[model samples]
Target: MYGHGYTQPVKPPPPAGLLVLLRVLFLGIAVFSIGFMAWAPLLRLAIVTRKSLDWGLFVAAMAADVLSIVLLGSEPGEDVRTAGGYLGITLLLGTLAVGSVYYLAADIRHFHQLRYPAYPVGQPRAAAYGYPQAPTPVPAPYTAPNPRQTPPPMPRTPAPQPPANTPPPRPPQRPAPARIDQVRAELDELSDYLRKHDEGGR
Candidate 1:
């Protein structure tokens, strides 16, 4: 994940080297076939350099051609009287064997250049485009403070008092005494009412 305003570009994959692998495979197969299909390595190398031929591979293929020609022209066999006799065929096959090895090596080198490049390709894309920038504001010049006019003292805040954990115990008042006084007054009035009723009855 990217952090707040920054963006990261996706990573690109490296080269596969499939052409180099194919050339090697053909060379391996030609080895087992005893030079019967030696032209396969050349075909693979040609296809690999079709777009832009590498100087190394080009030189290797040219060398292989010249070596094969020299082997065919100079040797004579025990049975044949022609220029490329049985001994010549053997030497030509040996040249083909060598060609398979070097061609594979050259193709590997060419494909390697694709992955690990030689030139300077790391230039930034946005280096040339200049964006419009806001002009900076000029800072005001500083002035010394006057010593004659002293600055007013800052107001001090009162420190808060710590609250008491437990409150003082208040004197307990007897509510039952007041209630009994009220009942006594009501009982006197009730007795007087009973005496008046009795006199009225007599």
Candidate 2:
């Protein structure tokens, strides 16, 4: 989007019939200054008849006018009176050339504006040139996916078991010591064997 500061070149209105007539008069003077050059006369004729000037003819005419000026200015030395007359003629031709150039430039600008006018910023340019305005494209609306088209569900993970539900580990057991009764029984047997030996000796 362009800001309010943006501006378009406003085309000047077309020249009226009187203005066109004046242009023709100036163009004729230019053509005369160029010694009635062929292309200049043809271009002038086209203008008078309300026809577009041919690009080739326009170029040729301008070239001929420039050549004419160069040739006239490059003449050999002459008397003071002749030089004065040449200077006056040169000035007149120069004026005519300037006028003709301005007139052609205006005409070309007008034609271009007619064919392709500048519209204001943010405005439709095709409308200015008498073309139909094109429709603005709209994006399509979004929609939710159908249940039948949905993807399969992912596999579920198992939950971890709580510590309280697990069994406790048992403590390590030590080996049992010898019994006192067994020790006493061994001592009694030894005493009995000694007594029987003593009796046998007596």
Candidate 3:
């Protein structure tokens, strides 16, 4: 009456190691994008020198690729063999990974070089985009204070009136006293019968 039947299905086999490696390499590239193009200043710095943040990212990608290869090769029930397929995947993903990093770094540098700040301190007012803006006009200097004139009073809302004199609803009535007494007597009779039956059986 209290059993729950639950079953766990078997997992499907993973793709070939080479295919898995390629996927991992793509994931690495995606992860590196966070620090590369996403942060333009770092990309620009990397562009100036071949060894910038991108180098660190590139190293991390290569390490991940090697680790993935080792893990996939050793995992049980995998079907990887021979050198051709292995070498092919490594070379393809490696080339793509490096090229993608360089391409993204270059794009970031281009954007940084082209982009200019809208507001620059110590610059000419007319050339600045959001600087100083036009000053609002002021009312002619306040004439001598007029004590007699007062500001208009604010208006207030009145509270709502309640419904005319109605009594609250009453609660439901309980069962009759005679009915309660009858139920108590039946319970006592059942208790006496059980006691006698239990003693006689013993």
Candidate 4:
């Protein structure tokens, strides 16, 4: 009994050094394009007259494509057929590899359109921290309370004189006063001295 194993055709690895060489060639082609316009007038002519060059390249590429198709269908056991298929696949892969540059260019163009424009140069940006400062509020003018209206005074409770039998209230202790004559004389002397000094200054 045979175990179930999926039978999908395994694609062969790209021909030896084929992919690498094609990449180098494409890079050279791009470099040539830049130089054509910048350094070499003759190279620029080839690029400027690209319509004819494109058609020529397209025809060659298409021929390579047809060859590839024939090779893919051919029997590998037949030497000629196997060789043709290998050559076709090689050419087809190279053509696609070259065309990828155009795809990349178109992608760049599409991305450019999607991009947002830059903010105006030299214009200052708002701060990312605090909000804009608010204007100061002016204080209201002061108004005096109405003089005519007055609050009624609170009722005072008079203390009843203690019953005569109750012990007489002890008087609060008071410290002896400074000499009245001395204090009065000191005040008079200070006032007179100040007055004389003020008059002399004037």
Q: Rank the candidates by TM-score, best first.
A: 1, 2, 4, 3
The lDDT leader among the candidates is: 1
Q: Pick the candidate with the highest TM-score.
A: 1
**Residue 6, candidate 1: how far off, in angstroms?**
25
Looking at model 1, residue 116 earns an lDDT score of 68
What candidate 4 gets wrong by more than 4 Å, as runs, is: 1-50, 76-81, 102-202
Tell me the lDDT of model 3 at 171. 97
Clashing pairs in 3: none
User: How many Å off is the CA of 136 in candidate 2?
Assistant: 16
Model 1 clashing-pair count: 0
Output the worst ten-in-a-row residue range by lDDT, candidate 4: 35-44
Model 1 CA deviation exceeding 4 Å by range: 1-24, 51-84, 120-202
Clashes of each: 0, 0, 0, 1
- The predicted structure with the larger lDDT, 2 or 3, is 2
For each candidate in the order shown, give its overall lDDT on alpha carbons. Answer: 0.64, 0.59, 0.54, 0.54
lDDT of 1 by residue, 97-197 (tens): 67677676767676677656564344433332356544445557889999999899999999986579967678998789889999999999999999999
Per-residue lDDT for 74-113 in model 3, tens only?
5454564646446634544554456465645554453444
- As for TM-score, the candidate ahead, 1 or 2, is 1
Model 2's alpha-carbon lDDT is: 0.59
What digit string (tens of lDDT, one per residue) describes model 2 on residues 169-200? 77886544565667778899989999999999
